[model samples]
Target: MYGRMNNNIYILLFCIVFLISIITFTTIRIITDKEREFKKLPNLKAWKYISILIIVAITSFYGVEIYKSATNYGGKLAWFIERLKNERSVKFEHNNIYEFGVEGIFEDINKEHPLPKKLYMASDFDLTFNSDGIITAFDTFVYGKNAHGKEETYLIAYDKKKSQDITIIRNGYANPDYDDDKLVEPLIKTVNAIPVKQTVSKWNESKYGLVYYGKRNWGYNTEGIININEDGKEHNLEKSTSEIIGYTVSIFVPGKEKEVVPARYNLIGDPNWSKANTNPNQKSSKEKQQDLTNSKEQFYLSKEVGYKLNITDKALGSTFYSLSKTIDGGKTWEVINNDPFNGTIGSASGITFLNDKLGFLVAVRPSGTEGELYRTDDGGISFKKVNYTPREVKLDSGQSISPFDSPGMPYEKDGVFNMLVGQGSDGDYNGNSSALYQSKDKGETWEYVKEVKSS
Candidate 1:
């Protein structure tokens, strides 16, 4: 809507200029008619009509614009006029950070704002909070047109406790004629210039309290370099290709004001540090191989007692399964059985334990059309495949089909073990509804109850 208004304004100005030019030329020609060539002139009546139409069009466009300004902008005529003069717009975005153990007005420039050709706009607002939800660090950028109408990009970093603001000129064309000594800082930090699409924050249980990570392209042209200005001296550092193509992780720990290190520093030696420091989205060759060869799934029956299924040795599209028990809150694990599914060749979809000695493990084939259900009576020490009894289900379309192609783990509800069996991708009857089966005798045998729709 705003774009259409701007276009209309431009068109209205053009028409007004055209009408003025036509009127001025006609009047001059009539006054200098020395040869009495007024009768040979173009249709003056038509020109007068054209001029009236242009005037009416301009007036109508202004009337519509004024109405819109009154309705949308609370009748702020000066504000609307200023927006027209600058040919720019501003938008606000607010983010809720309560899930990150912090609550504040995390408002910043909307990412949908038009990119400035000469100026750098404030694209993102990043905050680092402590364990108690106290904001310790803030990172953002400031941008606007200078007195000479040139754009300026200033990277800003604020320390909450120190109450100091660190600003750095990002773009090469930024004016440095002002007092640079006051802007010089002992601690210079790099900030993201591009708009951040997604941000992930993790609680570092080691040294750092909370770590905020932001993902964006850090190529040579996009990477933000910390250009420190000391004693009114500014330096523009060039980006190198060796810079890792990964996300930037900001580590902020309370009470360590001066120890804010770069994301490249693996101070905590987290296992995922190497992966995130390299390429976060892409997995390495070794990691991919490991993913294909090995997998683990855990199900906790209680706060301290849990069971884990480890599928390993992927050969010939099959893998060996083992069940491990952890009684002391995952501190130690004990492998009870080497082969729970009697050497089944499928992926373990789920593992559920009703008690310490009774559990079920489900293994689904790669096609997901069929699966093997194993039940253990002696706490995963031994296992035997349980064949589920199939029942015909009548669909709304009057078609009867067995919908128990893939069986899920049994969950105890209302003193009964209930399980849902899906029809997999091959079945599309009744919106791919699952057949709910209930076991009355502790999952010893199952009976068909009813059809359950996939929500």
Candidate 2:
């Protein structure tokens, strides 16, 4: 399929080049003819007509390609076109108004907007609030086409306090792509009388909630306070036109303006913020290692000894994990084996140890409906695939089925090791059930127990 698509792209490119060459050739001939005899050429009119047709053909081909790439089979285009037709479309509006409250501000700023015609996604909204928990300013983008039909963003800033009607403080193509490098020092350098908090509004009901940085109590200084000296000249945050400031976001419910809590904050001098400035849009090595350590699957045999499986790499729908042993209560860890499943491709579902010398590891395939079970007896130094005994269970239609799809980690219950092999997402009987297995000789082999139904 992809090869055919690549061939089509090559054909399109050739057609574009051919059409452009004709256009260029005709244009140069028409311009360079000193005696103007080019206009009297026998096929001059015919060539002109052919040039127009070629231009239209090229345009139509480009339009078709753009549509296919943007809509991915016409699923997104209809709704987006409808949004563009609406009068209140956020796409063209320069200013927006909301009620004088937190919920209203949040709803208006974070409301769903039409997919941008040119940009990657919808416009982002930033809100600024005063110390009294009142939203004082906000900024959002309006998109429109230039004379050339190329879309561009109009970044607008508004002030809410100057009037019940929102006041437009600034509007321009100053930061069309919202690139931080284009920021300039504001011309009006007034210290905000009221302490302010700035936050990016939550969009699309994000599960992660609103994102902000800074000290909750420090509050953001509207004027740049931090200063940097370079080349015998001192530049402060405000002087350099740095928008960076520590600010806190407040959480509030409707009709309860007085009941607000400082939910999250980002401070300028905070350790994370400083690291971000040094690294700029990427995690530091230490931070990445810490994240990997935090996500590691661990099985502890005692307070002082444990085993952990850390994901090392993932490629082509397969995840690789590195097994490590930790002594002295996880103070330090040494990698025991890099390939626990011997190059098997899947996700590490669970890892557990029965003793200092016996352990089990479960890996689920990318399909989620199948997995592999492995056992290690030499303290996780090596592992070998273990097979569970499959059992047949009667379905709702009185049909007997054996589901050996997903195998879970082994756990000791009532002095016996029990494991559950699940049917995963492909189960049609008992709503994707599991088959329980038991091991009496410490996870070396398994015996069929019974089918467990999904709750």
lDDT of 1 by residue, 11-129 (tens): 77897998899799878877888356566645568878997998899779878876776442234563345335332222211222323222122123224332233333222344564
Name the regions of candidate 1 deviating beyond 4 angstroms: 1-296, 394-400
Q: Write the per-residue lDDT of candidate 2 for residues 1-455, one digit (tens) a residue.
A: 22246547988789799889979987887778835755478657898899899889988977776666444123245334433433231221222212232234323433543223332101233454433344555544344444576654333334554444332211122113332211211100111111122221322111112212111112123232332221212233333222233333333232322333223322222232222223325655644443223221566677668888765654223457789998865656889999998887556767888789998888766444677899999999999999766677676789876776678878999989998888754566666777889989888889988777777
TM-scores of all predicted structures: 0.36, 0.38
lDDT of 1 at 82: 32
Top candidate, metric TM-score: 2
**Pairs that clash in candidate 2:** 185-241, 213-265, 213-266, 213-267, 214-265, 214-266, 214-267, 224-238
Model 1 RMSD vs true structure = 25.1
